[model samples]
Target: MTDSDIGYLTPVIDEDGAPFWQYAARGQLRIQACASCDELRFPPRPCCPRCRSFDSTWRRMSGRGRIWSYVLPHPPLLPGYAEQAPYNAVVVELADAPRIRLVGNVVAAADAPLDSVDPELLSVGAPVRVAFTAASGGVTVPRWLLER
Candidate 1:
């Protein structure tokens, strides 16, 4: 798909996710590593999910993972995602975490719908990794995929 399809990637840019996007623009995948317990967190937050420590550092990730859970959005789902109905919204278990999960999309196009990836090719525990796409104002953010 063309870049025109990646229209809704506007990251809210709150305290947590801003740095992650900043790094993504440079083609780096970042995850929050807790300074206290050394746990890696995703969906970006200040505190570590393990130790609940406010101290953390942004660690560059290997950008590799496996599908932990997933779903196909169907008719009568979230209206914004209806056009992309049957799109896969998956929770991936980062290789670094194995226990921690990151929710993202699985599509042929970074911004395309779940339908872009044939359901036959998707399954729990499938290999996946982080990918990036252009976003508003020339920024970039992470998207998920079945292949590199």
Candidate 2:
């Protein structure tokens, strides 16, 4: 990876999130869905909060959402994200799950600098959609931006 390249180094899949990451590697966005109540959840887990059932499935999402909240960090950022300071990180409300939201980075384009989006462009309730970014190790991450 080059110094200017900004992205996750390796697949960070935990015990509960392994399936989600594995699916994302194939250009799919899989989120946890409660088998009982049919509730959609992000950041996969073993048990559903709504139904409290261990039974869940990997459901593909439309990859479309609206910007719910955003933050442009000051100079200091947490570890790996520090290099991309001033970047807009947002919580996106998926249309599929009006109550659930996913966190993602709002960027200009796939090839554009990760930190290039100006703060003026971001606003609450902005319409945004997911774009799966291809990366090494057969990983595809959902990067967000204004829907075109």
Predict model 1's lDDT versus the native.
Answer: 0.75
Off by over 4 Å in 2: 1-11, 78-83, 134-139
How much is 64 displaced in model 1, in angstroms? 0.8
lDDT of 2 by residue, 4-122 (tens): 23544445557888887778767677788988888887777888888799988888888888999998877644555677777877899987777778887888886455687888888
Worst 10 contiguous positions by lDDT, candidate 2: 1-10
Residue 55 CA error for candidate 2 (Å)?
A: 1.2
Q: What TM value does model 2 have?
A: 0.81
Query: Model 1 off-target regions past 4 Å?
Result: 1-10, 49-53, 76-80, 109-114, 136-139
Error of 2 at 104 (Å): 1.4
lDDT of 2 at 39: 82
lDDT of each: 0.75, 0.76
Report the lDDT of model 2 for residue 94: 85
Report clashes for each candidate as comma-separated counts. Answer: 1, 0
